[model samples]
Structures are given as structure tokens and as C-alpha cells.
Target: MNRDKVVLAYSGGLDTSVILKWLEIEHNLDVIAVCIDVGQEENFISVKNKALATGASKVYIIDVKEEFVSDYIFPTLKAGAVYEDKYLLGTSFARPLISKKLVEIAEKEGAVAIAHGATGKGNDQVRFEATIKALNPYLKIIAPWRQWNLKSREDCIDYAKKHNIPIPVTKEKIYSRDQNLWHISHEGGNLEDPWNEHDKDIYMMTVNPEDAPDKPTYIEIKFEKGIPVSIDGIKYSPANMIYKLNEIGGSNGIGIIDIVENRLVGMKSRGVYETPGGTILYEAHKTLEKLVLDRAVLSFKKMVSEKYAQLVYDGLWFTHLKNSLDKFVDNTQEVVSGTVKMKLYKGSCKSVATKSPNSLYNEAFVTFGEDDVYNQKDAEGFINLFTLPLTINAIMKKEKNEKEKQII
Candidate 1:
């Protein structure tokens, strides 16, 4: 009898590699390893060979870097969605896209279930499962980390060893990492201790701040409708833009953050994230927005941004609220076209200057020098009207105090 096939989100890492074998051995299912490439540094040929060698009946290596950048990263960037004011939601948003691919592949292959390597304690479990459920509620979702007897990474390593499965991690250097076009996140091991300082050796895709060059680097980015279009006056595709910025920003030791964040599963987890390009893009974009957007619109958009971040972080990407917020974000982006010059030095990325065609800044009206527009006399009337409520309240309070003193 032919066994039922199950699609596995294979990353060629220890967790997913072991999960692939476990699903086949324990559940008697034919595992189809599906690797969705989002511009992470990986050898797809090696990943494919490893999956096949580890007893996967078949393997699919799909490149989705362009789609990831245009569809997911740009949308989040446009919304200015940052989780907890620190995390760029690199791992958060990728999970939904990965899960979407898993659902697609599972349906195409007529698979009965979709399996993943997300741990029971992390937010990824919720992110992956929520997207899966939203897309196709009929497919069964299998998460081995929650079901398997393996209590920890060590146990999983031992299981891999017994099964003769080649793994990526060792006990001495065990850090759970997720990488994509936007950023890379490191968790587990030393990071679990919030007090422990992350070692400089853990750095990838970036140099340490202390090791960065002494001189500062300057670059200009141009954006059209909130999406980055060029760097240094040269236009680039969405994926290429990120790659270029990462190279430039990484050398300057920019975009490294360490934080202890609350997980969706109701626990605190410490992780270090490196988002060189994304950090630069966010700074430049916000600088442009400040130049173009009105005071009230910018203030209200700040609230919407926080809510959008929560929605994405909580795995509500497919909901109606996020869709509505996306529309609002797009409407705001209409005037967000501009160029921003940035300076990068020693892990710092700052916007030095910005200009926009739709800028609200009026030098003629606010200039300190003598000008035709006479606004000096109008200020007295404006201030009186603005402070009317305060003035009235103070007068009433003084009169009431005088009456009380007389009676006493």
C-alpha cells in the first residue's frame, strides 16, 4: 500500500532535518521536503542532497526572493511596522510567507498534512500554524517539537546521531537562527540568559562596532511612494536593493539589536537580531515621511503603525483589519516620494538630510528674516484663542478662592 505524503518545510538545519526523519519513521508518511528560498545564504544543492540522503522521497527548492521582497518586506516597510520598538519582525513576517508556500505545495502534491520545525515555546509556532489554518483549514498541521519525546536540543542531537542524520549544530555552539532577505535572528543557548552579553563571534552579515572602519560612510536613497527605488542615484530591484544595502551597512557595523521579548506563547525569550539594510531603509523612509506628511497625519499614522506591528507579530496577516490598515498606509505613501541622505558609522545609521516634492516645510512663511508674509502680529490673537480654556479655568479658580477666603 502506498503511504500518504506529508509536506515538510525543510531548511536543511538540524531541527527540520531531524523532523523530516522522525515524521517518516514514527508516522509512516512519505516526507516531501520543501525549501522556500528567501535570499538566505544557503547552498540549495547541498540542502537538496541532504534531504534526499536523509530519506525524503522527493525535494522542492523554490526561490521566492523577489516575491518575499516585493510582497512581504516592502509592505511591512511601507507600514513602518516594528515590533516592540526593537525587533524588525524579520522572523515574524517570513513565517507567514513560508507557511503560505507550504500550503500551496501540500495542496499541489495532494499531501494530507504540513509539518514544520517551529518549537512549542516560540512565536514561530503560532505564526506558522495561524497562516496555515487561515489558508487551508482542511490540512493537518504537524509540529514535532510539541509532540516528540525530544526534550531539548541536546536530545534532538542525540536522536539525529542515532539515526545517522547529518546536522548543522553542535552542543558547544548551539544557537537557533533564522535568516531571510530582510534580517537574521539568533536565539537559544547563551541568549537564553538575558544578562549574558552576546559574543562578537556570533556576528554574521555584519562586523562588530568596534571593528568597523574609523571613517563614516555616506549614501543617498530615493523612494517613490514609500518603496525604495535607488541607492546613490542608481536604481535597483527590490531584492537587489536589500542586498546592496546589507553590504554597505554591514561593513559599518549597523543594525544589531539584542532584546528580551515576550513571545506569543506567553513567555519571555532573548534574541539578537541583525538587520543592516532594513535599519537603514527604515531610518531613511521615516525621514522622508517627516518631510512630506502633515503634523496630524504623521501623529495618527504612528498609532496605526503600532497596531499594524501587533497584527503582524500576532500572525493576523490575512485578516480584514490588516487589509484596512494597508490601504491607509498606501494612501499615506502617495506623498512619501523623496530622497534621503544618510550617514553610517560605528553601528549608527542616521538620516542627515531629506527632501520631498510634496514637502510641507515652508521656508517663506517661517523664516526669521524679513519677508512679505506678516505673521508676527497674528500670533497674539492665535495664542489668546488657543489658551482660552486655560485662561477661563484659572480665572474661575481665583474667584472661587477669593470668595472662600472672604467667608472664612
Candidate 2:
């Protein structure tokens, strides 16, 4: 007799590896492991072997790095969606794409259910399940952490050891980490305490700011309608662009933030995130927008940016409102084409110069030097018209005050 099949989002990490064995033993289901790669530095061959060795019926390692950059990362970047003004939403947006892949694989494998290793308390559980339900409502969702008897990472380690599972983490040194092309986030362990500072040694992709090079690194990034196109006059593919920037930005000790953030699960969690390339890109894009976009559009886009960030952070990527906001963001990006020169030094990435064909900054119109434009005389009329309502309110207040004094 054959057992029912269940598709698992396998990361080859401790949680998913143990969950794979648990699903086989407890649920009596044949687990088909699916690992979606979004440009994480991982050995795919090793991940595949580990999944098969851990009792998976079959393993599917799908490379979605290009799609992750183009479809997910770029759109968020274009919208200037930074969660809490710090987080780059690296893990946030990745969950929906991963869930989408899980659904697709579950359907193809004819699996009865889809399983994930996200814990019950985390936002990922919501993100993964929400996308799955939105995309394919009929598929059964199994959350092992919610169902299992294991209470913590310590218990998970014990289970993995008992099952002879090859795990990446040990009790001595365990930090829950999520890495991709956009960023790497570190949580768990000492990070649980808001007072504890993140270890400098925990950094994987960047150097400590104090250890960074003495000289600043300068680079020019060119954008086409808000999408980053080239660096230093050399064009690159979407994924390659991020990869290159990450290398340059990482070496310069750029983009590191440790924050106690409000999770969607109604709790505060402390995490340290490294988003070197994303930081550079966001700064450059914002600089370009300042040059190209008018005051009104830029002001409104700031509100949209906050909303877009919230939507992505909460895993509402597939909703109708997000689609509509994307349309608005895209419209705003039409004139956001430009080149930005960035200075990177000691963990700081700043835009030093920006130039754009669609720039709204008219040097002649606002220059202090004498010019034929004759803007000085026109300012009196403009100021009077702009302050009309204020003037009327002041006059009425004076008249009322005078009447009150006479009556008194």
C-alpha cells in the first residue's frame, strides 16, 4: 500500500530537515522536498543529497534567482518599500514566491498537502500560508512547528540527532538566518534579548565597519525608468546587478541594521539584517527621484512607499490592492530614469551626485545670479496668491479681536 504524498518546502536547515522525518513518521506521508533557490550562497548538490538522505522520496531544487530579482526584488525597490524605514523586506517578499513555488510543485506532484518549517510565532507562517491560500485554496497546509511536540530549537536539535539527520546548526552556536540575493537576516539565540548586541563575527557577507577600507569606493549606477540598468557604464542582468553591488557594497561595510521590530504576529522580535546591495540601490534610486520627480509626486509617493512596505511586509503581495499600487508606482517611475554617483565608506552609502534627462530642477529658474528669466519680480504675486487664505484668516481674527475689546 502506498502512502499519501506531501510536498515540503525544504531548506536543508535544521527545522525543515527534522520536519521532513517527522512528516514521514507521524503523518505517514511520502515527503517530496522542494528547495527554491533565490540566490543564496548554498551548494545545491549538497542540499539535494541531504534532502534525499533525510528520507525524502524525491527532491526538486528550483533556481528562481533571476525571477526573484526581476519579479520580486526590483518591484519592491522601484516602490521604495522599506519596512519600518530600515528593513529591506528581503525575507518578507521571498516568502510569497517560495509559497507560490510550493503550490506549483504540490499540484504537479499530486501531493495531498503542502508542509513548511516556519514556526507558529513567526511572520513567515502567515506569509507562506497566505500566498498558498490565495494561489490555490484547495491544497492542505501543514505546519510542523504548530503540530509537533518539539518546543524550541534545543528540542529540534535533539530530534535531528536522534534521527541521525545532518543539521547545519548546533546548540553551541545557533542563529536563525535567512539569506538571499537581497539580504541576510539573523535572529534567535542572543538576538532574542533586545539589550544584547549582535556579534560582529556573525556577519557572512560584509565586513565590520571599523575594519572597512580607509578609502571610500565611488560608483555610478544608471537607471532606466526606476529600474537599475548599469553600474559604472557597464550593463548587467538583473541578478548580476545585485550580485555586483553586493560585492562592492559588502566590502565597504555598508547596510547593516539591528532593530527590535514589530512582527505581524503581535510580538516584537529583534533581528540584524545585512542588505548591502539593496541599501546602495535604494539610496541611489531615492537620489534619482529627488532630481527627476516633482514635489507633489514625490510627496505622495512617500505615503505610497510606506503602504507598499506594509503590504509586502504583511505578505499581501498577491492582493488586488497591491496590484493597483504597483500601477501607481510604475506611473511614478516613468520619469525616474537617471544616473546616481554613490559614495560608500565605513558602512555609509550616500548619493553624492545625480543627473537625469527628466530632471525637474531648473537651474536657470532658481539661480541667484542675474538672468534673462526675470523670476525676482514674479515672486511677489506668487507669494500673495499662495498666502491668500492665511491673510484672510488673520484679517478676520483682528476684526473679531477689535470688536471684543470695544464690547468689553
The most accurate candidate by lDDT is 2
TM-score of every prediction relative to native: 0.99, 0.99
Tens digit of lDDT per residue, candidate 1, span 1-408?
Answer: 999999999999999999999998999999999999998899999999999999899999999999999988999999999999998999888888999999999999999999999888888888988999999999999999999899999998999999999998999889999999889989989888888999988989899989999999999999999999999999999999999999999999999999988887888889999999999999999999999999899999999999999989988888899999999999999999999999999999999998888899889888989988776999999999999999999999999999999999
Over 4 Å off in model 2, which ranges? none
**Each candidate's lDDT (Cα)?**
0.94, 0.94
- Candidate 1 lDDT at 1 equals 92
Tens-digit lDDT string for candidate 2 (313-350)? 99999999999999999999999998999999999999
Error of 2 at 277 (Å): 0.4
TM-score: model 1 vs. ground truth: 0.99
Q: lDDT at 337 for candidate 1? A: 96
